[model samples]
Target: MRENEGGQERPGGEVEEPFGFWRGGGAHERVATGFEETPFGEVWERFLESVDTTNVGALTIGYWGADYDTHFVYPVPLLVEAAASFPNLRSIFLGDIEAGQSEISWINHGDITPLLEAFPALERLKVRGADGLVLEPVKHESLRVLRFESGGLPAGVVRAVAGSDLPKLADLGLWLGDEAYGGDSAVDDLAPILSGERLPSLRHLALDDSQFQDEIAEAVASAPVVARLATLSLAMGTLTDRGAEALLSGQPLTHLRKLDLSYHYLSEPMMARVCAALPGVEVDLDDQQEPDEGEFYVEVAE
Candidate 1:
């Protein structure tokens, strides 16, 4: 059917209603009549028809397989609009299927304040390779988890989150690409988040890196006092003895229960050092094993 840029209906073919997930598509449920193809907006309205509850648990949408390139030039707004339509929506997972779409560019083009403004019920947000988000102004009471994947993020984005009223937030995850790794990276600028006035309510933080190693560890160790932080996952492309030391020594995650340092970048010496430093944090299954040093062991708390 033909439609204007605003998604307003013109005239022609019948509006294509949103097909739900089922084995046989439209054959499973009686198609709703009077459904007009008004554009993407109408499609989205039809999509919202599937939601019956005033409150929602989560809303996640992104490219899968070839959809990454063949689909919309930008899908964040559609997902965000869905969140707005559902006042109960709690969490969002806007991640792409990385297996084949890793090469696509994710550049931040403008501010993301409008999205936050539209979805006041938003709580947990996960975006990978979503760019141009001015996250400083978002102030949602239900928000507690914020995770970003790739693309250049302005320095102090986390600190800006600290300024918001996301007190219930318990997890924060950030990943900077190879350009911001190691000593030459922007690891130092994250001090605001790792130091004073940090996200004090945080309980978990995961940082996935493509290149940076030792510098990333040091930066993580220096994170500000998050009294509830219990887990730290570092997925670095490269890690050395110094990196392990930086990750293990110092900082206060006294209640920390899990630490994942399994990248092959760590040498035997580095692994040993981590065992010595953390005392009881276990080696992730992905890491290789050697003779027991008997210095430390980890058990899932019962």
Candidate 2:
């Protein structure tokens, strides 16, 4: 199932998609817009004199329509002075502009840990609209995939990634939004990644698009990071059936291989008992909306 180039499906690899500015590891380049009639630091100094940031790897700084409320393309000190001429940079995706450049719950992020400590061989990081985002407690030594695509994700950026110290993190996603777009983040502010004590070589956990998704699926089915996930996305939340019966009454998740639970609400007898409680996993219960505005909701608010 080879597909890559953002046409996705690379279960194996040979990936290199992103174009404009450039991209590498999980490549992503897309920077050219209305130019807001030019002069946002001279269009990032003409995108730093037309790329070739010494073999770029990933970059995206899209559309600042209406100059993002008075020229807001901070570009973290021009991408940390262009990550010292990017000798094969790791990854970065910031404000890839959507909701027509305004309503990814009102984009306006900043204070990005000085380009994550000026890209100390950054591994992967994605940030979409989190309203003046910032970070502290960082301890990166070869960071690995930490994404935040907000429609409102802030409780000081989920406690600054549960007090950062990413020991080779392995893909942790978040979009817990809707405290009127600043998403105050409480479920006791995700008690240190739901008691997994933060990414311990995590294998892909997406606590996606939330409104507390059944209290984060009963605390991620008794998470000690769900026994080190293989892939466990709680896709586009508002998951009903009391959160798929608190994710089938916990414990035996059969060492999950995949369990997306897409755009949920679950009823055809609890989505057929959550696909017979994962009969060899791979269960992505697709778009099943039912109850109108009274109950089921999380597809992204605001």
TM-score of each model, paired residue for residue: 0.65, 0.36
Q: Tens-digit lDDT track for model 2 on 1-302? A: 00111322224774423222233454345564554466456777777798667666777776554434476566667778778887677877777776754677666667888888888788877777777677666878888677787767888878888878787887688878677777778766776875666567777778877877888888888878788777788878778899789879986787777788788777799899888878998898888888786766667766
Give the best candidate by lDDT.
Answer: 2
lDDT, residue 109, candidate 1: 28
Clashes of each: 12, 3
Candidate 2 regions exceeding 4 Å error are 1-41, 46-63, 66-93, 96-101, 105-120, 129-141, 150-167, 174-200, 210-225, 228-236, 252-295, 299-302
Error of 2 at 64 (Å): 3.4
TM-score, candidate 2, is 0.36
**RMSD of each candidate relative to the true structure:** 13.8, 15.9
